[model samples]
Target: MEQDLLPKLKETSVLIMDNATFHKGKRLQELIRCAGHYIVWLPKYSPDLNPIEKMWSRVKMIRNKFRVKDIDKLFKDYCNDLFGI
Candidate 1:
């Protein structure tokens, strides 16, 4: 999933993430670090402070609209469209 995002990132970016176990994997950390983007872990229970939360809402709405069987691909494509990635 992080691999898909690499193409969308700017030379310098700050990736704000929640404290999900999958989000903190060593491989993903290394990927972001190598890409020269820093990670900022958002505090628990502060979805209001995160722009991705809003993005997720938008994505979910689109997902529900399409009723896709392959949600992962749909999400990536939808995000790419939404953000012009």
Candidate 2:
């Protein structure tokens, strides 16, 4: 993730994520700092600060509209329903 985002990040860029165990390491910190970016970890128990949480809520509501269990069919259905294709 760091490798891909590093080239695209410029000065004053910030990356945001929750304080999960997988998000930390000395190497990762060095890499981010070298790229002139910053990390802003979300506060504990603050779901409102996470925008992706709201997107997931909308996705779960859409999931209820589909009954198909087949992965391939579900992929096509999801694209069609979401994109009107």
Candidate 3:
């Protein structure tokens, strides 16, 4: 993933990352600095502040509504419902 992202550094600007310990690695920090972008870290223990969490909750609700036999179909249905919500 890092290799894939390295080439896009020129086009990248600010990086928004959650308060995850793994994302705070030295190598990651170096990479972010080398890309010449500011790293905006979100507050810890604040899922309500993250818009993606809302979409995920909606997806879960939609997935539970249907009796999907295949994992791929369930994922597709969840994404569709999320977008609809």
Q: Best-fitting candidate, measured by TM-score?
A: 2
Candidate 2 Cα deviation (angstroms), residue 15 = 1.4
- In terms of lDDT, the best-performing candidate is 1
Question: Lowest-lDDT window of 10 residues in candidate 2?
Answer: 55-64
* Total clashes for model 3: 0
Per-candidate TM equals 0.56, 0.64, 0.63
Q: Tell me the tens digit of each residue's lDDT in model 2 across 1-85.
A: 5758788766678889777677787788778877788888899888899998876665566566787777676667667877987
Score candidate 2 by lDDT. Answer: 0.76
Clashes of each: 0, 0, 0
Q: On residues 12-57, what C-alpha lDDT tens digit does candidate 3 reach at each position? A: 6787787778888988988877777678888998988778888778
Report how far residue 8 has shifted in candidate 3, in Å. Answer: 3.2
Q: Candidate 1 versus the native: TM-score? A: 0.56
lDDT of 1 by residue, 1-85 (tens): 5658877876799888898899989999998888899999998889898877898888788788777779787877797778877
TM-score of model 2 (CA atoms): 0.64
lDDT of 3 at 3: 82
In terms of TM-score, how similar is model 3 to the real structure? 0.63
